[model samples]
Target: MPTITLSEATFAKVKACAEPLVDDADSVIARVFDYYAMHHAMYFNGRLGIAKPNPIRLPIGSRELTHTRLLTATIDGRELHRPDWNSLTREMHELARKRLGSFEAVRKVTSANLRQGRFEENGYRYLPEVDFSIQGCDANNSAESSLRLAKAMSISLHLTFEWRERDDASHPGQAGMMGWDPTSRDAGLMADGSSRSWHDATKQAIERIARDRPRREFTLAELEALELGRVVKETGSKGATPEATLRRVCQELRDEGYLDFLDNDGTYRLR
Candidate 1:
């Protein structure tokens, strides 16, 4: 964790809030932050105190977001009108640049490596106006990027993502094609929320490849052939666009340092 300096009065106040036997300074701070995450707070008698949650807020459930689209984001109660992932990424990077006092400082952290400074290699595009490199225009990627930046800058954010609800007969009791748990850090939630079936199918195929392949290298065709039936059974949907999903999965895995894309012909190998 990064070191932060606190005044003697503030430190004493924080110590007073700690648990008798179990809470250390770090734990106390974390506990306070956890409480703040769930509840609204206001100034009471010149001191901050818990307040009621805002009456008007987005319908973001406890579950992680899946198959969703970016609509707007409210940061520390200030709303930003970002219609798409590209706009949101640009906005967040620009905000970070300004706060840090230089684009070079921001780049040092976000670049692929300090030595190479390969921003584009990491799916980022340089913005001349902001003097920053923003991530690719992907809803989940952009959301994750913004969340990461907020954490680093100690800023607060509440994102609103929209998705079309699935038909009752097709999905039954679910709001959309799939449900996501909001608290999960895993990309399982909200990543490919709009087309969860394809996402799941691609993951399923990848799992089979990792488990069954001897050489650990396979083409897209082999994945489709081996796991199509199982993927259908698991997701309750056929592979509508296997090629596209495969490409998406490949890129995701590559970024995660799990697989290496071998060729334009759709061959990939586990690393």
Candidate 2:
């Protein structure tokens, strides 16, 4: 079994936070692990698994302390294990950039890393994967003060996923266990059965206009008079005519059974 040790300062902060709720180092470690596991499970849809940890001693400054803990857990029978830390860190940085209104400023203060290990218990093996140690430093504070603050505020989230089953079975792992790519956006359909990316808020506006004036057979000129046409014109780049965009939208609506093409005079009625 491999022992994972935290720095002296980190251990002190963790002990202080856990001391109020539990007695002894082992209980404190278990409580912290449980808290993280519960929150992680809540954030992502997955089954919760059990974690067992054994406390060990390590030298911290002049004192011998139980700052190292050996953890073992099995995470089989779940569709997804846990979210990737790199993706979470990138999201945090992006959010910070938006909130702070400066990308360069926020980039200077955030960092994260992933840790992994394996263990065997009672003839069964398990792999332990902790998500990250995400740290945020205050750029305005003095170097020493900032370091202290960062150490106190640092968070290490833990999670586990099954790896032994694939090895034992001598087969490749299931693709579903890998989870969805964080950067990939799922394609969504609009009311007209067109790709949601085809237009901005104009799609919703078009639906609203059609629903409001169900009995009204709209010509190209009449449709262009509505808010949907104005939105398409405003959002479109130069040379992208509002009339052309509106015509395409109507055709899509007609194909999706939401609109009836009235003759060949570029007119449509809501179905």
Give the Cα lDDT of each candidate: 0.50, 0.37
Candidate 1: give its CA RMSD in angstroms: 17.3
Candidate 1 per-residue C-alpha lDDT over 1-271 given as tens digits, one digit per residue, 9 for 90 to 100: 4799999998998898753433468656755654564344342331332222222121111222333444456654577763444566677677777786775666543422122223554445566655545545434455656654554455666665444233422222222211223233232232233333343555666777775668778777777676553443333223336455456556655755677888999888876
Task: State TM-scores per candidate.
Answer: 0.38, 0.25
Candidate with top lDDT is: 1
- Candidate 1 least-lDDT 10 residues: 54-63
Q: What local lDDT does model 1 show for residue 73?
A: 65
Residue runs of model 2 more than 4 Å from their true location after superposition: 1-214
Model 1 regions more than 4 Å off: 1-71, 74-87, 95-130, 133-204, 226-240
Model 1 / residue 222 / CA error / Å: 2.6
Give the alpha carbon lDDT tens digit for every residue of 1-271 in model 2.
Answer: 3467889997886777542322456545655665586678756555443232332211001011112121221112222233332223333433444454553344344332112233232221221222222232211111212221222223212122221222332122211111111122111122343334332343455556566764756677766787656655654323557777667656645644666888777777766
lDDT, model 1, position 13: 83
| True-vs-predicted CA distance for residue 28, candidate 1, Å | 48
